[model samples]
Target: MRIHLSSVFVDDQEKALRFYTDVLGFVKKNEVPIGEHRWLTVVSPEDPDGTELLLEPDVHPAVKPYTTALVEDGIPAAAFAVDDVHAEFERLRGHGVRFTQEPLEIGPITTAVLDDTCGNLIQIVHTA
Candidate 1:
């Protein structure tokens, strides 16, 4: 079996959408209203039919502490693959994205961590 959908807990869905789409270049896939929130999702422009990333709301009681701990410890909530980690890092930094970790090379892979602004740290990685 293969992966289908993964999610990142966000504090504000609209702001998250702008960052994910306008900044990160992912395209909107689905948006359905659900009571006080929406079932929002985005897909990579390169893989429109591939795995979808769900922009989940962190409204649940257990989510805040979990996300907080992850951030406090400098851990990434999710990772997205990019062709060039350095290039992506510079591009994101140009857009004023605050990075917790600059691109670091570890063996065959390179990665950088950036704050999503909506309360999560996301990583971008590339394998050389």
Candidate 2:
């Protein structure tokens, strides 16, 4: 079986687009307007045809509290794979991204958590 699409709850689509694309280097894949929000998604530049990350609107009341709790408790909403967690963390930091956890190695894997700016904490990891 193969994974397809995934989503991240975002407060603002436009701002999230800027951060995810301009800052994180993902490429825009699809965008379709629906009411006040759009069905927006992005894919890694390295794998344009791979899984797409949807930037969904967090308009539902429960989503705010749920995402807030996850952030407050240091839980990541989504984890992205990287070649080197430390290098990715440093690159993100240079772009003014706020990190909650510095790169930490545990066993053969390293991980770091950062604020997604919209309303979630995202993790970057590498496994050797």
Candidate 3:
């Protein structure tokens, strides 16, 4: 079996979509209405037809607290690999993205954490 889909909880689907597509550079893959919320997902530009990252709504009662806790604790909802951590960080910073942790060398990898402004911290990493 191959990995096809994964999800990251978001407080707002529309805002999350903008951030992922316009800021983080992902492409919209699907958006299907399911009950009150939509089953929204996005795919990486490098792998447009690859794994889908579902932008799951955090409005569900059980998930709100959990998602909020993770964001408060500075744990990223998801990590995205980048060609250059510093450059990507700068690009995001220029776009008004708020970073919680600046890029730092960690062994063989350099990573930075930033606030998506939609209730989650997202990590950007680069392997040296």
Candidate 4:
């Protein structure tokens, strides 16, 4: 009854790895070569043993349009929880990350959306 792993389709695995790790601060969990691509995954540094985020390649023909539509409609592909949405937003913005939506409160929660640079929008969120 829990998420063991999740994935975000990426155009380039190498670039995604660097962004998810070096920029977003996730830690590499596994990397195994699989033909021309690899089975690469990363985990949040705060939850190393928790769910892993797979960096999957989006080479399938359907993926482009599916992801493109999501982005065009301003829908986020993945959401990561943070302790403070504002602080995390500021920190990430300071790190040169571009956000589509700034932190906005909605009822008891707050969220911000950013482009993953891999054909998806990712949301960072917190609850009040």
The numbered model that scores best in lDDT is 1
Q: Candidate 3: what lDDT?
A: 0.92
Ranking by TM-score, best first?
1, 2, 4, 3
Which ranges in model 1 have alpha carbons more than 4 Å from their true place? none
Q: Which stretches of model 4 miss by more than 4 angstroms?
A: none
Tens digit per residue, CA lDDT, model 2, 31-53: 99999999999999999999999
Candidate 3: stretches off by over 4 Å? none
lDDT of 1: 0.97
The TM-score leader among the candidates is 1
Per-residue CA lDDT of model 4 for 5-98, tens digit only, reads 9999999999999999988899999999999999999999888999999999998899999989999999999999999999989898898889
Query: Where is the poorest 10-residue window by lDDT in model 4?
Result: 114-123
Clashing pairs in 4: none
Candidate 1 or 3, higher lDDT?
1
Please give the lDDT score at residue 89 for candidate 2. 92
lDDT of 1 by residue, 1-128 (tens): 99999999999999999999999999999999999999999999999999999999999999999999999999999999999999999999999999999999999999999999999999999999
Instruction: Give the Cα error of residue 51 in candidate 1, in Å.
Output: 0.5
Each candidate: RMSD to true structure? 0.5, 0.7, 1.0, 0.8
Instruction: Give me the displacement of residue 116 in model 4, in angstroms.
Output: 1.4
Return the lDDT, model 3, position 24: 92
Candidate 4 displacement at residue 30 in angstroms:
0.5
